[model samples]
Target: MTKHLSTPLANSMGIQDQVSFHRTELAIILSLYGRMVAAGEWRDYGISALKNLAVFSVYRRTAEVPMYRIEKRPKLRLQQGQYSVVGMDGKVLRRGRDLKQVLRVLERKLIRAVD
Candidate 1:
């Protein structure tokens, strides 16, 4: 006798049901990541795609907690804007409808790192 397996809830919902970064969004994030890596201010990173939000986390070391979290929440798109950069302490450094604008907070740190 063969046993039937049930599908996972996520699989049944399909890919579109989850939030994720688009190519253009990744491009922008990567550009900043690359620069930060080269500056030696950031040593590692992680990405997470969840039901309501997507996140790109930057770390100073592989084992350490992420120094920052860049999040995109579609539900917040109509409210507090869709993009945000959160500090290690979980405080929002910046939030805006424009990803570029929201990411400037990190860029400012990069500039300081170089100095």
Candidate 2:
């Protein structure tokens, strides 16, 4: 004879516990990434989908720390907007509700790099 146990952990196993970028959001980020890569300003990138937030980390090299991190926090969507771009030093360079607008900060660098 076997007994079945019901727990909160077990109940959540079937659900997706992590947050991630939507297709349209990824398109916006990747578009910026492609441009940066083409300009030789970025080399590698990483993505992390965590329980509360999703992060897109940009790297100049694989072994080094990420140069920038674009993050999406759904919890902040109502308060301070969900989209944010963080610098290498862990500073919030930009934050807004619109992903494309927030990403413009990085795009400015591309302009500088190209000039």
Candidate 3:
């Protein structure tokens, strides 16, 4: 067998890379995270890169489900945008082409002062 080292060959062999958030994407997300942390709204977070999507989960406390999840799905980029914010109940809070815009849904909740 001969070796075909090319992009087409790799694709033909079904070599798919996992989708992940870029450094800049994470930076923006983290900026909000930092603010939430300081406000005591969020205590922990998790990141997951899967075959079709990347997820950033925010938690108020450990050992429980995430309060919110930010997901990036390139497959939906052309249709309904890529960035999405999901609530803890698994509902889509916001979805948009711009990450910052989708992220604003969460930021709105942070605007109020904690009693």
Q: What is the TM-score of each candidate against the true structure?
A: 0.84, 0.85, 0.85
lDDT of 3 by residue, 1-115 (tens): 9895668977889988889999999999999999999988899999999999999999999899999999999999999999999999999999999999999998897887669
What clash pairs does model 2 have? none
lDDT of 3: 0.94
lDDT of 1 by residue, 1-115 (tens): 9675655775677735679999999999999999999989998999999989999999999999999999999999999999999999999999999999999999987655333
Off by over 4 Å in 3: 1-16, 113-115
Candidate 3's TM-score: 0.85
Candidate 2 residue-wise lDDT, 1-115, digit = tens: 9676655675677755689999999999999999999989999999999989999999999999999999999999999999999999999999999999999999888665334
Rank by TM-score (best first): 2, 3, 1
Clashes of 1: 0
The stretch of ten residues in a row with the least summed lDDT in candidate 2 is 106-115
